[model samples]
Target: MAETKTPTPMFPVVQGGGSLIVAWQIKGKKVVVVGGGEVAAGRILNVLNADALVTVVCPALGLNPEVAYRVAQGQVTHVPRNFEPSDLDGADMVLVAVDDPAASSIIWNLCKERHIPANIADVPPECDFYFGSVHRDGPLQIMVSTNGKGPRLASTIRKFIAKQLPKDAGRAIESIGRLRIKLRQMAPDVEDGPKRMKWMIDVSDAYSWDDIGGLTDDDMDNLLKYYLSGDVPSLNVLKGLPDGKDASDIDLFDGSFGFSVGA
Candidate 1:
């Protein structure tokens, strides 16, 4: 008999804190934020934008203008008192942003006992999750984190990455979705899931509209036509227009979109 040896794993396993990143759905969920300073205000805004029902547990005097405005509008519930362990009740997630480490630790332990996810600002060991610099483009979002370390650096890197993306990235994404639907309708015979996925991947990697100056309505029509009846549109169809217009002038590729990212 020949000796058999187990093969090593392809990727090294990392063991440490804050190594996993995930997008959590907090919509319509109850989130408790325990602080009233600027950091807490930022977290509150993020939760509010996610449509989470938020409760802020802090003294009435310390709230920043943005948080106070939301409270006045009834967008968020204001506890108007210092955080207590009881504040964590009914919370799906908790963010401890208070300045007092003792109070934050108490809240973190309580949340752990109750099995609720908790994040304690500036304290990695006490946090169940860490807030990251986030960039949003319609349905697409990118989050960058430094494992509970150096948030400023993470934010700087995020801004640089954001600048490299096309301004109409979201619209481009929608156009790609429409193309996927058309491709599927045209290739109904490809039934296997893996085969269909591979076909989509190949088409996406091989297809390019750069030679045509970018994606345009005419280009989309031509693409559909090619897929359906093998007719290719003229490459010069969108070449000449008054005042230097080109395919990039098309709304689908126009660089006129903007997105907000939060730290």
Candidate 2:
């Protein structure tokens, strides 16, 4: 018989070594952005969407058109001077976008001393978090990150994923969220947690995106009533629609879920 040997392991066995991704909530918090160039403009927009109070520390000459417009509109405060150590005061988060490496390093170190999270553009090692390419649709946001490598590639990947989703996916999510709230309010006191979860899963699995999107408030009430009675309602019972349907009826063929490369 020929000698047999075990193959070598192809990957590392370490666990919990990569970045811990999270949807951070920074509403009504202070975010200090250093520099007012194009890079800083992108950061400011992201923080603003999260409802963070932002202050940009940079010379007036450095402000890009977008950043200057924000300052003029009173959307964010512009100090119009070089960064100061006091800029970090009362900051919930910090982001550095200046072209000066030495100045960025100094700011990063200051954030470290204060235990504040920071992101230094183009300097992955100094960054506490890396920004990901994001796709936003109402309350839904999908992000793709390359762990500080090949940012453009990550963006390409995000677009690819978006192309596979249905155009009404976000609308479906909103409708389901409303139904979930109504279900919680109407659940009988005797329904246990597991029972409630099982019925929810069953209902979600039984419906398509278009079906869910087409549901009315009265339909939701009828569906929950059936579930509470130990019945997973069919499409016919809930909306008087055909019960046997598949994903082909969705809007996937329209190309990229209402998103385009230019978008």
Candidate 3:
């Protein structure tokens, strides 16, 4: 018998230098936006979707149609004047999109003094953080960032990634989340935490997106049985489950960019 040796791994060193990506919860938090141009409109919509309480400050004449519409509809509180230093009071975050460099600089400084995270649009040096191009589907979100280097390239990369993902990818994730919840419930003991995690890792390696997509309540019940048995279901068993929406049935790129996804 011949003994086998493990092959050396390629590109082993991990690369560094990038913003710490995280899903910041801003729901019901106050976000002050200074500007009313197209850029400001984009920022407003992004924060609004995150359920942030937004206040838009800029001259009424500065607003473009989109921002004007949002203000008219009362989607956000509109302070129809130049930004005031008092606007930073109780602000959880700030987004500055004003074209006036001097005014933007003032707001950035104020945010710095107050230790509020700020993004001075199109000005990397002044920004506490930069927004990434994002692709969203239901509860799933993928972001591509260039660290304020090339936004257009980030957007293009985002589009390419979106094109490659399954149309029902978000649904698959939701289903997996439900399974995770059930797994936790089944093994709620703190001592079983490691076992539960190991089982999940095994299941992840055993199943494909298509297999997971077709998972029904009955299938999940059957799958969970393996956790106690220390085994995983055979591929034939998973394949026998009912089919989900075919990936080829929908065109993911048809209207992908119809709306902006993130800030």
Candidate 4:
């Protein structure tokens, strides 16, 4: 007797109303784009953003002029040569576009044999995963992946979600980056990573409401002194350090670097 087949789930169809999420490191790695049209554009365009070395292989090609210009400018390398299954050798990632099921299958198999991750456009299962729309805000980049269900809708949602973030987010990330250096220098004697990390987190979290201008260099200096002194120091010793915020909250005794030069 023959067994009955069950219908596959329509998760991408149902839930892909707007967005999805994933994280990866693709910079300076080797990636191959196999195809010519807009399908290939979707892959090559983004790979360049990460500084990944990319090669687009297509025997017959139709590229938007800007992409062609970038190729000529050496921003991206393009190969007008035909793609063979073996062309995928030594790739960190492969994106297949030819729109030919047989060709896609051949390349997918080769990628599998070589232990490389690949994405097959317009065909989800054949791919490791499909591309999702991206909404970027400084260190806060949000991507919506629908398992490749509805890319148009995903991008649409990304546009709206992007508006929900503040333009100052990038500036804030930059500010945090600046603060970290000052933090490490200010508290040179604090030997614990957890403590240091906690300090960073607390300062950032505190930014949710308080005007962060309260965190000045002088305060940082006092806080470090209080933490490292290990003995009771006066309350006035640290200038910018937030009171009762962490282990550095209380004054220690007999500290060389107390709240004041007098202390």
Candidate 5:
């Protein structure tokens, strides 16, 4: 009989880098999570919130009754079993939250082999990616990450950071995003980062536009064109646009940019 040697644990692996991030609609799609612990429940909750059809596969779950009730209620599907390689088939997304490293490693290998993206809890060595600790208020979601270095520390800081966010922060970020797009279309030549940031600040802070109240959508179009093209005919131009009239119209309160994600 031949003796087997243990392989090396590949720690501190770089999972993802410098990639463009955006939210996607996942309603009625398949998302599989493996585990019965609080961590697994958390991942499932997030997936459910995103409107994805979620499936949980675990032999035993130490979760709340509500979650199990959801399974029984047919809102979410639960499979009472340990994982197998065949579980990877047709799985849009996979989450491995099991405590067994060997089982997690197998699931990760299956996902890799099948070209499915997988997130493994506390098992970065076998993870394709990770979900950040999230802080969401209405339209604002702040995500913080440490690139998988110190997850607990990163999450703790994010919690503290979230405590400091104002109620209208999400709306403000959305407003800025819309304004930036308008500027790009209206003033393609002068559309740079600094100018866009300046325009956002000006519109959100020192100046306010309140003339687009009764204006047609076409008028709003022209308004954005003018601002981005350096044709600031009037400070009142914003009023002639849509959804541009209120303290809640913009969410520039939070200084967080590119810091809204996973640790």
Candidate 6:
């Protein structure tokens, strides 16, 4: 038999490298951007969207239309100068979008000393975090990242996934959230409260968007009753139950419970 050669791995293993994805609340926080170029403009837009106070430092604002419009609208403060160490003062986050490697490196070092998070455009090794492709549908947000290995690929994947999500997915989430709060309030003292809560969450997760989006007041009441008593009630019966009545006194059916308006 001929000796077989082992194939080499296509990608090199990066030691101590993995991204911890998190949604940072930057509202009312200070964000400093060093560079007035197109890259810097994009970063500014994202920061502004998060309701953060942005201060842009550059000799002159670049030809980015959004940046210019925001500056005109007084939404962003333009320092009209080159990057300086003092610019990072009181900054919750810093973004370096300048073309000069030396200036970006200096800013990155200053951010490290100040213990502030920083991102250097096109320089993954120097960046504290990468800006991933994000998709937002009302309150629901999905972010896709390639760990700085492939940004374009991540964007493409994000677009594909965005199209797959239902238009009313966010509404369904809100309805389930309301139901969960109600369940917790009603069954706070139950011995199997945690298990019951988990069951409710699983059922909510399995519900079709149309089913959740179209839920009525009676539907919510009956759904909660079904989970608690192992009996689904007809709409008329659900309406008949007195408000604030003890759930234990409800007449529960002995057989399987069906979640339907007519059940």
Top lDDT: which candidate number? 2
Q: What residue runs in model 5 are displaced by over 4 Å at the alpha carbon?
A: 1-28, 60-63, 174-263
Q: Each model's RMSD to truth, in Å?
A: 10.8, 10.1, 12.5, 9.8, 14.2, 6.2
Per-residue alpha-carbon lDDT of model 3 for 1-263, expressed as tens digits? 89999888786766697788888899999999998998889899889989999999989999999999999998999999988899999999999998889988988998999999999999999998888999998778999999999999999999999999986888878778888999999899999988988988888778787777677776787677668866876656443434442222323332457742221
1-263 per-residue lDDT for model 2 (tens digits): 98999888899767764687899999999999999999999999999999999999999999999999999999998898999999999999999999999999999999999999999999999999999999887778998988899899999999999899888888888888988788777775554667778877887788998888888877776676665565775675455422342222322232446553221
TM-score (C-alpha, index-matched) for candidate 2: 0.81
> Each candidate's lDDT (Cα)?
0.74, 0.85, 0.85, 0.68, 0.68, 0.79
Q: Estimate each model's TM-score.
A: 0.68, 0.81, 0.78, 0.69, 0.60, 0.72
Candidate 3 ranges beyond 4 A from true positions: 1-17, 235-263
Give me the candidate number with maximum TM-score: 2
Candidate 6 lDDT, 159-207, residue by residue in tens: 9998898878888878877877877777777786776767676666656
Tens digits of per-residue lDDT for model 5 on 71-171? 77887788887776766677999988877888788888888888888988887666666677788865567777666778798799899998787546665
**Candidates sorted by lDDT, best first:** 2, 3, 6, 1, 4, 5
> Relative to the unseen true structure, what is the C-alpha lDDT of residue 209 in candidate 1, on a scale of 0 to 100?
31
Which runs in model 6 stand beyond 4 Å of their true positions?
1-17, 181-196, 216-263
Tell me the spans in candidate 2 whose CA falls farther than 4 Å from its real position: 1-17, 188-191, 240-263
Off by over 4 Å in 4: 1-21, 181-191, 208-263
